[model samples]
Target chain A: MADTSSPPALHFTGHRHLVERLVLSTLTGRPIRVTKIRSSSVTDPGLAPYEVSFLRLLEAVTNGSQIEFSYTGTALAYRPGLITGSAAGHGASIDGVLRHEIPASCTRGVSYFLLPLCLLAPFSKSPVNVLFTGPGVITSATPTGDVSVDTVRTAILPIYEQFGIMNKLEIRTTQRSNPGPGGKGGTGEVQLIFGHQVRLPKTVHLLNPGRVKSIRGVAYATGVSGANNARMIEAARGVLNPFVPDTRIFSENTAAGFVPAPERNNAAAKRKMGVGFGLSLVAETSTGVRFSADVAVPVEGGVPPEDIGRKCAFQLLEAVEKGGCVDVVAAFTALTLMAMGSEDVGRIQIGRDVLGSEDIVQLARDFKTFGLSGWGLRDAGEGSEDIIVSIVGRGVGNVGRKVA
Target chain B: MPSLAPLGKRKRPTEAPKSAPATKPAPGTKAAEPESDGDSDLQAIFKRAFEAKFAPLPFAPAADEGNHESAEEEDEDEDEWTGFDSESESESESVPAPVVVVHSTPSRALEIDKSELKAFLSSKPPTAAKPTPFPSSGPKPTPAEDEDSAANLKNDVALQRLLSESHLLSADRTSGALDPTGKNRHKALDLRLQALGAKGSLFKQEKMPMAHRKGIVRKGAERETKRRKEAKEAGIVLEVAQKAKGKSVGRRERAVDAPAVGRFRGGTLVLNSRDVASIEGPKFKSKGKGKRRR
Candidate 1:
């Protein structure tokens, strides 16, 4: 690992880089300064409540973190002070955990703030349990690129599992609240419980995603006629039933982990009801690689449900055909994990033109910022297959994770 | 966590895994290298890949327990930072103390039942049961009706069976059809089987599948369907629960399903889930082909 003793201060404009910057800064013990948030954009300028709430949430996790925000709300200086985990001699027992149940500000998805926690949880001295209250489903009002259970399940979980730290992962949607964009309901609550301590990931070479083994999905309707769920399943299945060998769809009545379907009295509930429907599909390969795609029912109509189903099915097909251990969306996330893993060979197959994408290449640059090395982006040399981003974690791992 | 081993061991190109491009070997890692041979990872990957592809896949990938310890006496003293201060720094004041717990949420630890945990680790929703991890009998027969055609089956065991009948001619080739390239003599036999039709069956659509015809989702889809049925029964169950609790007003909720409109609480917890419908792969390829070809 490179020395972080004198790493320069990080500067950013707008709130876009907030999560990534915090995640990296926390690990490296560096300070970050974010300035001019939405100064250029006149429409809804300055920091939103969600951003402030995000900072407050961060404060709740750490013991003594310094956060200085400008009066105009344009400039903010954050110096990570203390990480709250476990006490000494408590390093080996997984029982030592710092639990914080936060009432997440409803302006955005909990996934936005959850990323930093997920990344930092492994390295924290103790396991972390954060219960967030926010819109459980992604909506137009939510910030763009906010992750959900979909990405958390397919992207983050797999990366942690490779580190032999999977036994404790739990992200159950305990309660469904107000659907986002516009709706009136109780705020949804999701409890994300994970980690005892970081199990430094071993060197991995995940080049091939292998063949698609099974494709399954769920179609649910909320505040609308339950029949909509049936239509979605039928339409999605119509598109998926030709190529996939094993396909299944769950409806409002059958989707797993749900408390149970509620009666839809559109006339009675009226304005209180938020009408929406969606489908979630996962294409799992023989090699343990999973590609997931989903579609939410649109507020506007005439866009057939068949198209939604077809889009999801094809997205998964592309993922499998791309032949990577990680899906395209998950490629960067996996690279981030590799950069932060143990000091052994780690490799992942991102797309052939992965380096063409600026964000993907930024991963290498970000690793450099953390003062970690023995990593690079290189051609897998299999005649234009997905490029493999390789790394050796500084072996920076925490102790005292008890396996309950 | 990596133990501080002696650093500055010269690079062994022959030992590095082929799959890994170990660029810019850092100063702090070689000392803590646990595997005796670096090439072992490359070999293990190839072996695992071969087994995963060639043999049946239900056989899980093996875990390397780091047994390859080879004692090597260091010849040269390493760089100044090679002796590494990881141990001391790890125990620094920045260490997080396990306090400040908010008792609002459920404080359940990872005491998951083994069977239940396995299913969760499988990454399926809670409704999905644990997949049977084994191959029965001699050669595992590839089941009829790949996932594509199986969606329509939807728990109609009879319909599912009909969709997957052996459509091709028997190995004996009594029907005088030429064998195809695939290992299965009846690979496309179902089509011909349907064409030939069952004895005394009048119409093409009227013909029923052989009672024993198989499907790949022998257990899974059945269980999924059964689960779906049970979930449907949950409505009645929900009513029962409501009657038992005698609460007629509040709306019910389901996990990852459609949003259940609970009685409008003043405080709304708005967590957003991303819609997975967006992808234009073909358009992306065509648009980027010329720009990315080089």
Candidate 2:
């Protein structure tokens, strides 16, 4: 190897792409420096709490890492250490839960942090586990709805599943959290666990997302009129039923998880918090493609069930229209798995039209960060919109992972 | 710094600038040795670009020996190779033409074209107009010979084409003028006329190598369908039955182009019905008046 003694370093301006940078650095075992994070801002400017928490999680997972930051906190440097399963490097039994759970930072969706875990998990000796804290860790990208557990369950988990590690991985929400402006960050708790001793990840070949068969969803209401959940479901179904006659929308009254919203103490402090309620729906196709859309009650006045329902319905339809085995969000993750697969070439076929987005543009840039083999990525050229990406992996077996 | 500019500027919008080998995922094994320094010229250029953007830091240790060539190449070319060589994987596929799918729905069996026949019927003299219910064949499957032959071909001579008898309308002919409210048969006929008039272009078909184009997929077909399609003798010709007895004027055509429109109701069939004929009754002109040599 060129120089494991001192890794190559990269630099950047802000934390906008911080998560990607750090995750990439950790994976490549390269060092990097970042500068001018929120330097332009007069407010308590620096890396956001989410960015800091992500770094902390990375540090927790790896051993002998070196991290330095400027006193102003605007500039920082990181040298990644070896990524091992057991906190103790050599030999130890690995259990994610028994060790400790990295607290998922707020404002940032845990998927942002969890993604690196999924990428790194299979390679580690021990499975990775984390419990999210901060405000709104267990909520939807939508305003108020079911804990995002299902949304990601269908979207993110599939990445790990494609790697031959189905039972070894678990990402489930223990409690639902509602994101609110009044310091109640939904406080929903979710547990993510990666199993140790996963089977070697193999290349994946997913193609042809067939037509959508039906829509399954959850309409959740918490700390609000329980009827609001029903109303949201009714409204959403009304819009969706016209297009998809077989929609199964169930209502889950989620408010029981938290104490009554009266700021918990003085009954006089009770101001009507527009009940936290929303809908989460996933449209499944005959070809294993899943499209998810969420609509939650906003922080301010509640959205009429009609609007939320219609918007969510249309959003699902739009994602289906994009025509891929994976949606735009899931495309990058699935591509990453293929990027990290077996030693031989791997290919995946996706609807051609979806590749024209900016995500693919960013992905191209990101794909370059990983050193590829044989001039790495290639698209098997044909005259259709469906494409097959081929790559020969620099196989990432769980080489140096140690047990507790 | 990597140029903020897009990777492929000279490409059409549909061909996304994708497949750049960002960071190759770490394989389970060590990177292969660069036996010969004769790597791709494009690779050398981009290596330099990456080095300038992320030069090795001062305190950083030496570049990994395995990739020392890449690191060294970067430092050597830092002063040259300013032009951005996008890491786009395929030169031919980076910028694909916009996807223009033409659903060539084949022509359906005939139905009574009332509106087409109506305008002619109403315009004729009462004596000439025969207000008839469309021929009984109007609602039935066209009794055209080719369809009859197709029916004969099936072991049981099956009828009513299951596949969309409507051939896909090529993108160009789809926009051709056709009455929106008119019958599907008329639209089909209009499309046929457009195709016939625009024949040579469609005849010498060129099968595009989808993989050659950025977004074209070769999933249903094996990989490299484009290579086979491009090098093949003929392009894909959709299997469809010819227009049902299109050449033989059927009863439907007979009804629309009836003798009444051209001939006067009470006049002899031999009488000149041209607009130039003495409709002196209309303009009240002398029948023998010399043609005005304006």
* Candidate with the greatest TM-score versus the true structure: 1
What lDDT does model 2 reach?
0.55
Write candidate 2's Cα lDDT for A353-372 as tens digits: 56667666556566575463
All candidates: TM-score of chain A: 0.79, 0.82
The segments of candidate 1 whose C-alpha lies over 4 angstroms from its true place after superposition are: A1-8, A85-107, A134-143, A181-186, A252-274, A299-304, A353-355, A399-404, B1-294
| Candidate number achieving the greatest DockQ relative to the actual structure | 1
Candidate 1 docking category?
incorrect
lDDT of each residue in A367-399, candidate 1, tens digit only? 676576746667777575667767777666443
Q: Model 2 segments beyond 4 Å from truth? A: A1-4, A85-105, A134-138, A142-147, A182-184, A196-199, A256-275, A351-354, A373-386, A401-404, B1-294
Q: Which candidate tops lDDT?
A: 2
Each model's DockQ? 0.02, 0.00
